[model samples]
Target: MLAGLSADYYTRLEQGRERNPSAQVLDALSRALELDADQEMHLYRLARLVPASRGGGGREPVSPMLLQLMDTYAATSAFVLNRTLDILAMNRLAEALFSSFADTDNLVRMVFTDPAGPEFFTEWHRAAQSTVASLRLAVGHDPHDARLTRLVEEISAASPAFRQLWEQGHVRGKTAEAKELLHPDVGRLSLTFQAFDVRDKPGQQLVIYQAQPGSPSDHALKLLESLSANYRDHEDADLP
Candidate 1:
C-alpha cells in the first residue's frame, strides 16, 4: 500500500513543501519504511508534529537541590540524566561503576560504543532495546537538540545493535526492574533500579541502583564502596 505514493507527493513531503501529514499518511509511511514502534515515534518527531504541550525545552537545568539529593546517596549508585540521557552528575558509587570506561559520563555512548559493552552489560540485547526506547521518549519531547541528534547519529553509525533497536520505534520510560551487570573487578552483580522524574526540570531524571539486603550484590557494593571511598567525580565543564 505504501508503494502507491506518487513520486511527486513523496518528493514534496521530503522537500518540506507539505509540512504536515495526516495520521493515516504517517501510518502508511511507517509501514512503507517498515518502521517499528521506536522508529514510528521518531518519524513523528522529525515531522515536528508532536504536541507542543508535551515537548519541552531541549536542555534541563540541574538544580542544586537535586545535586544535594544525589550526595545523600554517597554509598549507593545514583545519577542524574537530562532529557537526552546525558549524565549531568553522579554519586561516588555510580562513578565507581564506570571507572574503567573512558566515556564514563555518557550512558548511551558507554552502552553503544564501548569495547566491553556486550560483555559488561551481560543483558546487552534487552538493555539496548530499553535504552533505545528511552531515547525515543526523550527525543519525542525535544528533537532539535544537537547533542541528542549527534549522539543518535554516532551510535547508529558505530553500532548495528543500537541501530536495529532504534528502528523498532519502541518507546518506554524507566520502570522498576532488576538489572544484572558483570563488573570487571567484582564479577556479577544484581541490583534494582528506580527512576524518578524531576518535576521542576521537565527532562531531568534521578536514577538510583541498590542491591537487596544480604545478597551477593549487596556485599559487592560494600566492597566497591570501600575501594572507591576516596574517589571523587571530576569536574569537567567541557565534558559532553
Candidate 2:
C-alpha cells in the first residue's frame, strides 16, 4: 500500500486488466517505486497516459546550420546522435576518431559488436554499461519504436554481455563524461565529452569531445585532425 492502492487493484493494474490509470495513480506509483526521472517518464509513456516527447523512429535530417556548427570544431570530435544512438551526422575528426570501427552508425553496436570496440574504448566495461543505460532511456521515450526494437533484438541475440546488462533495468541519458580511447593512429587519448540536447529537435543529442589544452592528448588530436584532412583530400582526389 505504499501507492495507497489495495492488493487487488495493484494486481489488476499489473495484469493489464485495469486500463486508464489516472495521472494521480501513476504519480503515486512512480513515487512508491522510487523511479528516477527518466524511468518515471517511461512509465507514463507505457501507460499511454502521456504523448511521446519526440519522434518514435527513423532518421531525421540534421539541420544545415548544425552541420556548419559541427564543422567549426576543427580540432574537436563532434557528432549528432538520435535517441537510438544512430550517428546522423559527424565532423571529419569525429569520423577519424572512429575510423577503426567497421561501422560507426550506432553507438550501441560500436561498443558491443564491433571488433575494435574492446580495444578502442580504454574502459570497455564502462562503455558497454553506459551505452545500455542510454538505450534504456531511449526505450522509455518510445517503447513501440520498431527500429529500436530491431536494434535491441539484434544486439541481444549477438551479445551475452548486452543481454545481461539489458536485464539489469538501468535507465540513464548521456551526460558529460571523461572518456579514454586508444585510437589506432593516435594511441591513447584522454578526452572529455559533453552531451547537449538539441532544443529544437527533441531526441537529438550533440556530443563533442576535447582534450585538455597543451596536453599530450591535445597534440594527438591535432595530429589526428591533419590525418583526417589528408584522408578527406585523398578521397576527393579519387572521385575523378
Candidate 3:
C-alpha cells in the first residue's frame, strides 16, 4: 500500500539528492506530505533536479547599501522586513512614523492582536485587509514556511478580524502606498510609501515613507521626532 516511505528516501527527495521521480511518484509523495502550492513547486523542481537560483550576492543579510540608504532618509520613515513579516531593522524615522510598532517586532501581529493598534490606524479596516493580502502574497512565495503557518494560526485564533480578512483569499503584489497617518505626537501626516524588494532575498521588502515637502505633515514629523528623542533619553536614564 506504500503506507509510508522510509525516512531516508523522504530526506533524499527533500534534499534533491534523488531526482527524476515519475509523476505518479510525485503525486503520491505530495499526498503523503500534504504539500501545498509552494511545497508542490519545490517538489517539482527537486524532481527535475533543478537548482534554486541564488539571490543577487546570495541570500540577503541586510545589505550595507540598504543601511546606508536608510541613513539618508533620516527625515522619512523606513523599515526592512522579510516575507514572513519579520522586522529586520528600522530607522529612527520609521520608529517615529509608526511609533507603536517600535515596541513590537511583527507588523501583522501588531495590526490584529494589539489593542492600541486599531486606534493607531485611522483606516483600520483597509489597513487590516491589506496586511492579510500581503501575507497571502508571502505564502504564495514560500508556502512551506513554519513561521508563516504559526503566525496565521496565532492571529486567526486571537483576532476575528484577521480570520475574516484571511478567508477572502485576495492575492497581491508588492506596490507603493500612500497613508494618512495620525500619530499622537505628530497629529496628521499624509505620507507616500514605497516598497522595494531586497535583491539578495527574493521576498524581503524595504519600505520607505516620505511626506510631501513643505506641508504641515513635515512639521508633524518633526514633532514626532522630538517626542521620540525625549522618550529615548528618559528610557536611557531609567536604565541601570
Candidate 4:
C-alpha cells in the first residue's frame, strides 16, 4: 500500500517472476525499503540499471571526462574502482601512496593473495572483512558475472580468512573512512578517503584519499609525490 504496488505484484517481484519495474515503482520500493543514499544506489544497480561488470577488458570503463577529473588531483591521490574492487585507474600519487599497483590490480586479491598483504594494509582484519563485505554487495548486482564468480572461487581457494568471512554472509557497501597504511617509503601514514559515485555510470566509484593538513602523513604525501616525480621522469610509465 505504501508503494501502491499490489500484493500479488510484490509477491511476483519477490518470487522472481517480475523483472521490469517502472521508475516510479522503483522510487516507491526504495522508500519502502528505507534505503539510505548509498543503499538506494546499490539497490538500483542490483536491479540492473548498470551491470556489475560490462563486456570489454577486465577493467571498468573509465570515460575521458572521468580520467580528466582524476588528472586534476595532483596532490591528492585518486583512483577509479569497479564494483568488484578492481583498481581500474589511478593518478601517479595513488600508485606511489599504495606502493605499486602493477601487481595489486585487484584489491580483493591484494588483501588476500599478495604476500605483502598484512604489511600493506595496517588494519588487516578490518580490510579483509570490508573487502569480503563489499564483494558481497557487488555480487548482488550481477549474480552471474563470470569474472566476479571466478574471483570468488580463486579467493575462496587461496585465503582461509576470505573463506570464513564469505561463509558468514555479510553485505556492506563502501563508505568514506580514515584508513591507515604502512607505506614502504614513507613508513606509516594515515589517510581519509571518499568514495564518490559516477551517477551516470552505475557500479563505478571514484575514490580519493587525503591526509590531514600538516600531519606526518601529509609530509609523507609530499615525499611520495617526489618519488612519483622521479618514477615518471625515469620510467615514463603510466599510472595504474
Candidate 5:
C-alpha cells in the first residue's frame, strides 16, 4: 500500500474503527497523501496526537504596548484578532472601517452572519471563502476550543453558505490580500491588508489595512478618519 499499511488496516482506519494510530503510521499516511504542512498538522490534531497550541479558554487581553502601537497608526486601519477571529482590539480608523456592522466581535460572524456583510464586502463570496479558510486554520491550532465550537455551530445553523464552505476542508491562515469594501458613508474602497503574528502571544495576530497613497481610496480613508474623530467628539460631549 502507498501508506505501507495493509488493505484491511487502512480500511478500518477509514471507517473510524482504528482509534489509536501511531505517529509513524500518521507520518506514512501524510506522506502518501502528499498533505501540506497545515493539513498534516490538522490531521495530527484530528487524531488527538498533537497538543492544543492555544492557551486559556477565555479571551486574552491585548498588550498595552500593542495598543499604543495601534494608536500611532492614525491614517491606517489596524486591529488585533485572536485565533477564533475575535476582534480583541481596534484602533480608531479600524473601528470606523467596520462601524457599519452591528457586531464587530468576530470576523467570521461579520462576514457570514451580519446583515450588512454581503453589501459591505464588494466581493462577498471571496471574503466568505477566505474567512472560512482562516477559521479552518484556527481549528487546527485548537480543535477543542469551546468558543470556536459554539461559533461554528451558531453560524452553521444560521447560514447555509457558511455550512457549505466549511465542509470543503480548506485550511489557511490570514495572508496579505486586497480587499474591496462598500462603506455606507464613503462608498467604495480598495485596500490591501497584511497580517502579523504578535511576538510571544500565540494565536494572536495584528492586521493592518492601507490604501495606495494619492489614490481615491487613500482620500476616502482620510475622510473616514475625520468622520470617526468627529463622531467620537460628539459622543463625548453628549456623555454628560
Candidate 6:
C-alpha cells in the first residue's frame, strides 16, 4: 500500500497531514490497487491535502445547463442526485411531492432517519434495501470518494439495519417502478418513477415520479397540493 515509503510516512499520508507525495507515487498506488476511475481520483484528492501535495483536483459542480434542464421540467417531480443520492437540486413539483423530505437534502438520510419513511413507502423493506444496495454500488464505482466513504461510515454507525444491507454488495440501477406513497393528508397515491441520465454530469442521474391520469392518485395529488399550501401559509405566519 505504501510503495517504498516507510510505515511512518504511510501513516502520515493516511492522516492527511503530510503533503510531499509525487504524482508518480500517487499513480503507482492507484495502479497497484487496480482502482477504477473514481477511486483513482479519490486517491488524488486525499494526496492533495498533504504539504507539498498537489492541490485542487476535486470534482467540478454540475453544469448550469443541466440545472436549467432539470428545473425546466417544473410540472413533474424531478431531482438531480449524485451516485450517493445527495439531492443536488429539484424543481417546485419535486419539492411539493417530497414535502416530508424537504427538511433534509440528503435522500439516504431522509429515508433512514425519518420515522415517516417506512409508513410512506408501500414496499418499505424493499425500498430501503434497494437504496442501501445502490450506495454499495456507488462505493464500488468510486471507492476513492472520501465524502462517500465518510457517508457510509456515518450511516453504518447510525443504523445497524443500513449496515447489514450495505454489506450485501448489491448493485442495480434504479429503473421504472411504481410506488404507493402513504401521505398523511393525501392518503395513498400511486406513482411511477422514471430515471434519466444527466448527460453533462457523469455519475449523476435525474429521477421523476409522475402519477397516472384519471386514478385515485390524481385526487390524492390535489389534496397534497392543498396540504402543502396550508403548511406554507403556517410557516409564513410564523416568520418574523
Tens-place lDDT digits, model 4, residues 1-240: 988899999999888898877667789998987777756666666677754554323465788898888888877999887878898888878878767334758889889988778887889999898889888876666677788889999999998999999988667777788788898888998999888877766678889999998999999998889888887877765544
For 1-240, candidate 5 gives per-residue lDDT tens digits of: 899999999999999999889999999999999987877887888888987665642479999999999999998999999878899999999999999999999999999989999999999999999999888876766667789899999999999999999999888777699999999999999999999988767888999999999999999999999999999999999997
| lDDT per residue (tens digit) for residues 1-240 in model 1 | 464678888899988898788777787898888876656866787676666534353455578988888878855799888767788888888888777677766778888888777777889877787778888776666657687889889999998888888887678777567788988877788988999878877767889999998999999988888777644323344357
CA RMSD (A), model 5: 2.4
Write candidate 2's Cα lDDT for 131-208 as tens digits: 998888777677778888899999999999999999997887788899989999989999999999888788899999
Better of 2 and 4 by lDDT: 2
How many clashes in each structure? 8, 0, 0, 0, 0, 3
The stretch of ten residues in a row with the least summed lDDT in candidate 3 is 50-59
- Among all windows of 10 consecutive residues in model 1, the one with the lowest summed lDDT is 230-239
Q: How well does each candidate superpose onto the true structure, as a TM-score?
A: 0.74, 0.87, 0.71, 0.76, 0.87, 0.67
Off by over 4 Å in 1: 1-59, 230-240
Query: What is candidate 6's lDDT per residue for 1-240, written digit by digit as tens?
Result: 446667887788778777778888787776776776645655554455323212211234667877687667634577877778888777666778777654646777877777767787878888888677566656444457787888888888888888888887555566678887877666788898898766656667788888877788876776666666688799999999
Residue 29 Cα positional deviation in candidate 1, in Å, after optimal superposition: 16
In model 6, what are the clashing residue pairs, if there are any?
18-50, 19-50, 19-51
RMSD of each: 6.4, 2.4, 9.1, 5.3, 2.4, 8.6
Where's the lowest-lDDT run of ten residues in candidate 2?
50-59
Query: Lowest summed lDDT over 10 consecutive residues: which window, candidate 6?
Result: 49-58
By TM-score, the candidates rank as 2, 5, 4, 1, 3, 6
Pairs clashing in candidate 3?
none
lDDT per model vs. reference: 0.78, 0.90, 0.73, 0.81, 0.90, 0.70
